[model samples]
Target: MAEKSGKAFDFKLFRRLISYTNPYRFTFYFVALSAILLSAFAVLRPLLLQKTIDESFIPKDEKLIVFYISLILGVLLLEVIFQFLFIYFANWLGQEVIRDVRVKLFDHMLGFKKQYYDQSAVGRLVTRAVSDIETIASIFSQGLFMIISDLLKMVVILCFMLYYSWQLTLIVLAVLPFIVFATRVFQKKMKTAFEEVRTQVSNLNSFVQERITGMKIVQLFTREEIEYASFKEINEKHKKGWIKTVWYNSIFFPIAEMSSSITIGLIVWYGGLRAAQGDVITLGVVIAFIELSQMLFRPLRQIADKFNTLQMGMVAANRVFAVLDTHSKINDSGKIELQNIQGNIDFEDVLFSYIEGEEVLKGISFSVNAGETVAIVGATGAGKSTIINLLNRFYEINGGIISIDKKRIDTIDLKSLRSHIAVVLQDVFLFADTIFNNITLNDPTITEDQVVKAAREIGIHDFICSLPGGYHYNVKERGVMLSSGQRQLISFLRAYVSNPGILVLDEATSSVDSHSEQLIQDATDKITEGRTSIVIAHRLATIKNADKIIVMDSGKIVEQGNHNELLEVENGYYKNLYDVQFAEVRDV
Candidate 1:
């Protein structure tokens, strides 16, 4: 979209990107100095060539010839040194700036609300943080500064050419319009091509990542061929986007090279004619003009290429900045920090909707006293999980107040609020790490002893010790090395060790095997002993002993009572749910 805009150069975006170099001012200034010196050095070589021909070789003085040769070699050596410094420091600056930007981008992403992630693709975010920032780095290393240096070199060469012979310079200028016109057209086309390339790259990344992550489903459902077909289509689009840029390049560079050759040819013919007619155009000037033509036109060719690099970087910056500009993060404006939170939670007529006018939880009201264990039961899509999400402030409620210990959750410091609660979801996620690290989450305050003590209390210590490395046994990604029951145990251990005042188990044992159900139930009873716990479950048997059971359907609570009390009520929501589940268990 930015590429479609008439303005090829976005000055505001360019300035914002340049601001990242503020911390590396010394390296930036050094690279700038190298550019100016390299430009000056480029002009000196051509002038020295003119002097060498006229003042040394023409006079037939061997001393002057050797002296001028030594000076030329010295200039060349200095030029090489400065050229290396320019490239090295320019790249160093680019790398350093991108490092800072990537860190900032990741940090910004971490603070975003759950709603943000719900609407975004993981691979697209990965591309922005990784590849897109890498493109921005090129803006410094090969794009902006390289364009500046090349332009400066061309200007210096032009100055030297005009001073030598204005007539010869005019002849060189005759072919300039064609190259400039071609370069402008090439840059514009390349800008759009680069934008398409980036978009396709993002799509390819997202497609591949989703497919790979869900590979088991693909194979299980025999959808591999279908998925591969989808991938081929996406991959083809990516290839086409890149090929368009190459097509433009294949057309533009030859035009630049031809224009340079034509200019050089005209200069030689005109200068030679003037010399034969006894005009002021000397042989030395003619020789110098030939070298200067190359010096001038080579940069012109390179600037066009480097300008595309600049354009691509600008496009990347625009996308990266768009993410940084997003206001989707949970507002952590609450200054209140609760110490030793009692975990008394209340949801007062709360309303929420993932989409506007389609409320998921409508007029939901609930209360849990300190140190109480309440079970929330419902059919699927009954806004059961939405309650847990709301409690954590993962999404702002559409209406009403959620509070802990009588203080509004919105008025409590987010970190402090979450610190007092630990949630163990049904679909457990574990890092590819040892059980010890997963339990402690690498928290320095939560030592191995603390984890072991908690595990023993929860009756899972024996199970952990039975493993090859005990607490040190690696679970691999998502605990794939372990079974569904084992991962649930690990999740329980993780929640317990945190010593949270409030614990939420969102269908923690829903997927566990029958053999592991007793261990899970025992572990659950042990952990919920004194803590204020909220258990969401589909099985009626698991929550029968709960002090309170809240039954929900659709988007509202239909019943609230203990198991026996709800069963006593005829045609009750909880009574019907219990009868159906109990019948299913009996049938099993």
Candidate 2:
């Protein structure tokens, strides 16, 4: 999470963000040049208006009047052209920069270890990747370049005002210090307000996402009203955040308008007195000073608003950079390629923990030879699932050497190693796409024919065809359209299509019905035949045919043997566990 800074502008962060625009350097430079040209043309219009009044109208020269009018029109036309270029190029640069930043942010997230996600909310990450990045785009499109253009126009206008009458210019600028002081106060207050708004937006997104995802639980527990009340509170906070920004704007803009009016009044009063004295000031000069004063003070007011946009963008950049700067990436230093891996897995004195000082796998040693089936049975929280996680290197181990085919696992390339391993977890996840896509996961090489063949081999082809559209059916989000048993079968088909050398089934059959269980068992036998398999068994009968059974208690292996051999022990943990946990299944 990013903390809000009290500084009005984070120049260091601004510089870092500007570096991303290097790729579109040409467009950025063009926009900057357009701003300069716009200022020049804008200032020319007022000077032309002053001259037309003083030289052409007073002397009543029609031809001169026509020439001055044409020149003023040309300046206006040039200003319009430059304005168009500025808007187009600035927006183009913003879009290009944000596209690159979004890709970089997503790629960085992909490299983060599972522990990072374990403690983070998915909605918060989504907000940073989507909404916050959009806010940063305003920095270029509406904030930075616009601020520069306004400032340049003000400077040019001030120079012209002084050229006309230094005394009148001083009179016009008397109230400017008060306006600048007010603007500083507005910037500081609005920065804090914008930060609060962003935080509230993230909280609102997280709350809504979680509630929708867990709607089943909420309904089952009859928590609709309670959840709605909580949401109302969050929504109220979000509303309040925006209202704070509105309140500040309301207070500051009125003050700015009052200051502008007062400056114009002071100039008119003093200039009128000077003209009355002895033609020291002209009528045209007084009118031009009014125009110049508006140009100067107007941007001061707008600069406050644009500065708010820039401040919000900086806050978003800070949050995004915080995610990029995280050092919790898993080490992928392995250079070895395990082509045609034999699937001989060995865990030597492995010690692990998901949290500090709370060891989950304590000095555990185990091995599964090539083409062997190993079943691990344990009570809940006996670290059965932890083994699967460690095998796939999802979490780093504290102390251990896990090897494949007598080669250290860490020495193998991360992608290549995971390519040869398949895991079918108890809670299977499927995308909201076609069944064919769910099975093949849109792998270009794995064609529709290949997926159908894999499904048929696993005896799920007929079951799939029974559904409307067969493989083309949309499963909706998270495969909600499918039953629990059907989803498990789809997961099996997905694993089988991959043809992995090592297969891990972590309670894969624990949540299915009897018919789905039969389908899964048939698929399991076919897929695990020629590969090394590790089964985290919940039901003892599921592992009765295994080559070896390892019973675990409190992160340590208590017994290791085949079913009959283990049952022969008088008071063995497996024997007692079987009687207590699986005797009813056996009778049924």
Candidate 3:
């Protein structure tokens, strides 16, 4: 677990966050100007009340009283207008900044290598990109600018109170030390509470997201009660985290309210005695002092709350910047532009490990001609899938030379290199969209007609047409509406439509029904006719007709030959695997 940051006010973070507002500085400037006007107007209202009570209301001057009332109302109207502009512009700027930041964060995430994602939870990333960014927005909407405006209003109010009666102002200032102390304590406690709350929120989101995504596994294994119990514990922590924040708020606000009330009582008592003694203090001065005291302390109370927003926003910004600062992206230093690659692939003296010092592929060497179909047969954990991951440069090899058409694969442009290859994985994924959209992936250039043609070529067009809405049928999330075989067919069509020079089917037919397997086999023949193809299979019967078969064990290729040639070798790994699979089929 990462240690929590101890610093409260991170000025460096504040400055960096402010830089995002550069694009909308004009709007921010408008908000600032409105704040100044609003502060001026707010001060004028209390002064107008003082004057009305002393001069207009106390005297028998109806006309003067009416004039003063109208003036006060006019000041209020302007205050309302400026307040509207301040809120509108502040929120608008905040929303705009968050939009840009979200996009930038997503783009940065896209550049991260598979290694980064391998250890990251999808739910945590979503939290950073969505909830964290929203919290940062509150720094503008309810935070820094609002605090500045409120502080300014309070400052203006203080100046007027002193000018009216310095004695009353002194009395109000006497209780200031206690308010300041209480605020410091409140802020410290709230910051800790808010931080914990955010952590719990992220944890809860991660737990729920994982559980919902893997609900099928839970149901299949009959682990619903166990999973539910685990979720309840997480949910309880989430509730406790928020309740802590609420507990702090309940203690702080009442203390502030009590202090404000005590100040009002003190003003009323002191001014009454002075007035009765026939001193300088009058009813108007006493009334204004009470109002001014409220004005002064109200903002102080608000500042504490706004500071919470600022603190949470800073924490969010810290997380977001951490992601932005990561340098774990794949090195796209290779500038080679090889268009229309011949699909000749070579892996020589390759070494790789998903974990350091634990090699999954050890000094492996292999080659595939431009237009040959090769089958890789292996048991679980034999580094079959790792081969595909390394080939596509999803991960950097520990030590190796992987080349295409005699050119180093690393020297080729990543986009261009990936454009010429497509892999249909065993666990096929489909979007919650129509069959047509899933096949084309919403690529504008790949027309519906073209997708239909590709599907027909793969022998799944008729099956697709039999479904309701045909090509336009919605597959639901992860293609949950379709059978496993139908999903595989969709994957095949998606791969075929790309017209990749090299086709990789990584256990693509392992989980499908026999009928679906036949369709996939037929699709395989049509699509891999002239393409360089590598098929990773556990079911040995699927690759009997391949041009060559490579048998692997413990990250090493133990045997390589055509089916008949390999089967003839007594005690060979391929022969044993083939015999075991054939016997199992016969038993079935």
Give the root-mean-square deviation of each candidate in angstroms: 1.5, 1.4, 1.5
Q: After superposing candidate 1, which stretches have Cα over 4 Å from the reference?
A: 1-6
Model 2 C-alpha lDDT per residue in residues 1-588, reported as the tens digit of each score = 444567999887898899999978888989998988888887787788888888889788899999999999988888888888899889889889999999999999998899999999988999999999999999999999989988999899888888889898888777888999999999999999999999999999999999999999999999999999999999999999999999999999999999899988888898877766757587777777888888888888889889999999998999888888777888999999878988999999999998899999999998899999999999999999998888888888899899999988888888888999999989999999999999888889998888888888889999999999999999999999999999999999999999999999989999999999999999999999989999988889889999889999999999999999999999999999989877676677
For candidate 1, the C-alpha RMSD (Å) to the true structure equals 1.5
Model 2 residue 109 lDDT score:
96
TM-score of 3: 0.98
- TM-scores of the candidates are 0.98, 0.98, 0.98
- List residue ranges in candidate 3 displaced over 4 A: 1-4
TM-score of 1: 0.98
lDDT, ranked from best to worst: 2, 1, 3
Q: What does candidate 3's lDDT look like per residue over 26-54, in tens digits?
A: 99888888888887887788888888988
Model 1: per-residue Cα lDDT over 203-251, one tens digit each: 9999988988999999999998899899999999999999999999999
The residue ranges of model 2 lying beyond 4 angstroms of the native Cα positions read 1-4, 276-278, 586-588
- Give the Å shift of residue 538 in candidate 2: 0.9
Give residue 465's lDDT in candidate 2 (0 to 100). 97
